[model samples]
Target: MPNRTDLEALPDIPMDDDGPVFREPWEAQAFAMTLELHQQGRFSWPEWARYLHQEIDKAKQSGDPDLGDTYYQHWLAALENICVDKKITSGEALAERKEAWDRAARSTPHGEPIELDRAIRRGEFDK
Candidate 1:
């Protein structure tokens, strides 16, 4: 994983005295995933930066407030784009996974773990 100095070098991402701030657990997860992927040589920091900047710009063009809170949302968007660009996964596959997650989330009780159903686990979405 990239060290603190490495992360601090990036001016685009928000980092305070305590390091990066995330509005939700998933936001932190996404941020960590990005770093992990970069460390694995899936993408370079510069490439990730370019994609993140582009995503933020696109969101701004679409009237996103560009508020600090939505930083992770843009980050996730860029991550998804990079994944697709690298041919790691297809857009349709992501959409299907998202839909499956939504279904799982909706079906589970509040505060319960949302588990993918058997169909989703069986790669039914790819069918």
Candidate 2:
């Protein structure tokens, strides 16, 4: 688990006095995923920081505007990049999973949870 100092080292993390503040459930999930991967010794804090910085830099280069709302997007991208680089998962697998989630979200009713398994079972994604 990341300590206070480690979390604080992240750039523009939407934190309050208590800790990191997430405006959406997916953001919290992404944060938790990163922490869990770190705890598993998949990557060091410095490696995570470097990947995150690279993602942010790439987004800025593409004219992201640095509005802070996209911080977690960069964080998620960094996580994916690190996972791919570490051979934990391939880019193609990530893209497929992302497409599956998109299909699930599109098929789900408003205010209902989007579930990939449900979508798959419903033929939204091939098993």
Candidate 3:
């Protein structure tokens, strides 16, 4: 298992590193939302961290140690894994949601929410 420093040192993700040198505003927003939910007891921080470390370890064993380049992807992937582990959603549910979204997007009002990503955010596809 990783120590406190190793886990705490994870880089800012979901940002274009070429210009900004750090996470962009929306990138920060998404990260914050996830962290906020975790802090609110929607999910355990230890569990989330464990999933991330597992994924990171898999990446390391698979021959990539330069995790800085894939931080957000790893984070997102680990989050998905945790959601699935916790039975929050499933692949079949997401496929159905996507179909529902396709139909909804065509006829729904302009202010209506997007479904696919929303489902993920709401843990609807976690199983």
Best by TM-score: 1
lDDT of 3 at 11: 41
- Residues 21-85, candidate 3, lDDT per residue (tens digit)? 33445454545555766766767766777777787778778887754766666676677676667
Estimate TM-scores for all models: 0.86, 0.82, 0.54
Clashing pairs in 2: none
Q: Which pairs clash (backbone N, Cα, C closer than 3 Å) in model 3?
A: 84-126, 89-125, 89-126, 89-127, 90-127
Q: Taking the tens digit of each residue's C-alpha lDDT, what string does model 2 give over 1-127?
A: 6778998888777888988988789999999998999999999998899999999999999999988899999999999999999998889878878888898799889999878875465664343
Q: In candidate 3, how many Å is residue 116 off? A: 7.8
Scored against the true structure, residue 76 in model 3 reaches a CA lDDT of 66
Cα lDDT of model 1 by residue, 8-65, tens digit: 6654567778677777899999988988889889999888888988998999999988
Off by over 4 Å in 2: 108-114, 117-127
Which is the better candidate, 1 or 2, if ranked by lDDT?
Answer: 2
Local distance difference test, per candidate? 0.85, 0.87, 0.61
